[model samples]
Target: MNLSIRWKVTLATLFALACGFAMAGFLAERSLERQELAQSHRNLDVRTEMVAHELRPWLRAHAPRFTDPAFQVLVRELGAKALARITLIAPDGLVLADSAVASEHLPGVENHRTRPEVEQALAQGDGSDLRASQTTGERTLYHAILLTEQDGSPSIVLRLGLPIVTLEEELSQLRRHLVLAFGSAFLVAVGLSILLARSLTKPLSDMAAAARRLADGDAAARIQITSRDEAGLLGETLNRMADELRAKIEEVSEDRSQLLAMLTSMVEGVMVLDYRGRVLQVNPALERMFNVTRAEARGRKFSDVFGHPQLALLVSTVLSTRVGQEDEILLSPSSRCLHIEASVAGGEQENEACAVLVFHDITELRRLEKIRKDFVANVSHELRTPLTSIKGYVEALLDGGKDDPDTSAKFLDIILKQSDRLNLILEDLLQLSKIESGQVLLRREPLQIEMIVERTMAMMRPLAGKKGHRLVENIPSGLPLVNGDEERLGQVLSNLLDNAIKYTPEGGSITVAARHVAPGGSPAGGKSESLEISVADTGIGIPESDRPRVFERFYRVDKARSREMGGTGLGLAIVRHIVEGHGGQVWVEGNRPCGSRFVVRLPVQPSDQAAGHPSLVPTK
Candidate 1:
């Protein structure tokens, strides 16, 4: 049912060989029969000619005496063993003699003039015919010749005939021999056909198998045929084609792998789009930066994924002009700023062009630039205010105010106060810069939280007293010691108390309290223990909106009031940096009824023993 090419070819070849041998055998048999028949006929003609010659004289002498015994003897002698019958006919169309019969029975024979051979002899001198004999009922060949008398007149017709049985028998023997020879030749031809079919089909079979292997992804499959024929040439060509295809496939695979690696490893977000503005590829960084998954991003429009009109416009521009473009765009919800660069990918036809977009996040860079500009402006304004005051006072002293000793003393005192303010501003700026730049080193030690609070309050008590504000300390006893620089901790509390004193009305009160907290109770979750210190005040309260940014550098909710009260805005900024450097957090809250509350939480020292103090502090 599924015969291979070899068998098919063999069958086809055997069929062809058989047909050729049969045709050749048939032609050979026919030609041999024709040659045998021709030779037989020629032999019959020669024998008839000889018999006719022998009877010519006898026929003349015994023209009408066919019953003569001597004449019958001559006719019988002439026929001899060669001819089946011999006869002589007179000119009167009567039977003269017939060697096939006795002389007395010859008179009963049919007339010879109407016989085809005799009539032809009379007209053409010699003639021949093959027919069934009327006299003996045998199949025979007849030949007749005209006999002329010595007087040159038509005398008698001499006719001779031979039965064809012996000739037919000889031809039958020849036909049998030819049949055997042709059969032998046919068998030999069949064997040779099988060999030829194998020779022709083996290489093609191997080639077919090799093609299957190639289809199944076997790159090394090859035909081993060594012939110089068409099949061999086809095999060579197929092997070369396979080699080329394998090399091209491997090259493409390697290039794809490298491109994927580069896209994955890059920090910049990358995306590729087709000419129709459909997303074709998106890298991991692009997915992360845009907050999208590959499944959600691919095949979607570029504008839909980024949701930024500027980015979409850039893509459109690059696609239209086949050029590169760059712009900065800000993504919403996350508020991330990205520097996007778009370009039409090269080595593509105009109809098949694609655009590539790369996103570089620059949010932090933009923030730093804004900070630098604000810092310079704030510093210049703060310095100019103090320098202007000092300069005005010195000019007053120089403008004859020195002539009055009292006036000169007042003017000099004003210059000294402004100079002190300038010095304080400079010191605060330097300290903030050191803290922010990581230049400040801490002498970390375990210290009592209550002692740090008491010392800071004592230093600020006079200022609060001058403002007629109450300064109260609610730090519980047996509080756990915090791991911090004691001097820096004191400075933090001092700044808080001082700010409260300056901002509060004369009758309002400020409270300082401390408690021990467990991990997860505070923002520092990994610490074993922590201390929470609160500096709450009834003062001109900070707005809820400004609370989050109170610790930013030079950020002041009431800048005019801050300056009037001899305060530099760097105190809270410095406080935040110091607390965070010590692994703590500081935040502001709205005080009850009025004013602001600042809470500082620091990790407690591991070596401190627990004193079993209550974490909740009573309100004052």
Candidate 2:
């Protein structure tokens, strides 16, 4: 029941044609009917002229014989052929001869001169019209003609009266034909209109269906039409338009997908703001980076979310100028400082719609930068303290304190101690710089792990005994050989042991243990061997919060205690570097009942080398 455009147009066109044809047929039929009536009247007029000519000679010969039998015979013959009634009127307007009734029985009519047709016939020789007869009272077409002698003088008026029923009967027959033609034309017009409308509207309906599918997000929808007319042209154009739209939409979708992927993949966070400085879209990386959810980030104003006036101002400035800007924005509320670089993009999107802001989280970079600055300051401070002490002691000795035996002895001892402390600081600084700069190379060699631990422990045993703490060595007798630098490994053990002795209270125990663990995680594959070395002490353990950063350079868990014990805070950092250089990992754990444990695991040997070497402690 839904009418299509083609059907509508076709219906309209066909209806117009039908109306035009109907009007033309009606007018043509009416004109034909009028022409037929005129021809009939002309025929009747010619017949009346013949009758008048026939009787006019008779009347001229004898006026008293007006109702003669010869005239009656002539009128009867004329009326029979012409389908009319002929009346011969005298010059005085009397009905002289009649064809239908006996001439004697017909009443003699007077005032025949007053008749319009008769008067016109007398004056102008001919006249005709439909009228009622004066005596007969019958409707007729009155055709009148004047009778003239050979000299052209008017005499009697011959009036021919034709009944109107003849013309009416012909008209009725024509009307019947017209009705039948109109009925047939109406049926044809309706059928052709429906067919034409269907042909045209089908393609439009298909295109409409395709458009609906496209609106529903189906890019593959298309209309199929093959013709050369305007409708076909429309279909082809619509299909092409749909194809182009699908392509453009697909391109945009792909670009958005790629943009989303890049944003999420980036370690740096990004935020986009609209012209009103409101957060519009955010990626997961930004959410994780800012520690905010998508709901919290969206619909929030920049200043409200970031709580930074400077950042909001920067965004506004970039938007106004339609240029890219870069600056470091601090998120003080989140306890994080970020080095951000932002750019203004798409400020002129049809109505100055929106701009983009990118955030890069450089928190670790900033922290490292601070550490570098602090390292220089701390190094200067530490060196300056030792140098000032040495300078004061040397100045005292030069100012004659050397002349007094006890005073000079104490001053010289103080200078020597300060000099030793300065040497130790310089040495540690140099070692730390070399390790950090990758200038120190490990001299890999086969070395006994137990021998190095025993030597370091022996050096620390005197101090441990002075504090009345037990120092125990638990190295397994058959431990596998470790592939590492002997001096570096010795240094690692010595540092861990020294810290244990310093932090442990009197009567606390320190234990050094080494065993061969599985080598599956080691570089020396195929052979299953790893060195498990642990230094445990029954001392105050480091807090869990401070454990992760324990290996950071110049990081001290107990600053005051470390300083009092003459610790440079670089021991664990050096230990980590050395351990990792040997393909090992080092971490600290809490020992039960108030103690700390530092464990180191290393590969037995390099996988690229042979399994055995001289001077290496072999497994029993």
Q: Per-prediction TM-score, please?
A: 0.67, 0.66
**Which stretch of 10 consecutive residues in model 2 shows the poorest summed lDDT?**
611-620
Residue-level lDDT tens digits of model 2 in 160-182 = 78776766677777777877877
In terms of lDDT, model 1 sits at 0.82
Report backbone clashes per prediction. Answer: 1, 3
After TM-score superposition, the amount by which residue 569's alpha carbon in candidate 1 deviates from its true location, in angstroms, is: 1.5
Weakest 10 consecutive residues, lDDT, candidate 1? 611-620
Instruction: Flag regions of model 2 displaced more than 4 Å.
Output: 4-17, 44-257, 270-281, 287-359, 390-420, 443-447, 459-470, 480-483, 501-510, 515-532, 536-550, 557-565, 583-620
Best candidate according to lDDT: 1
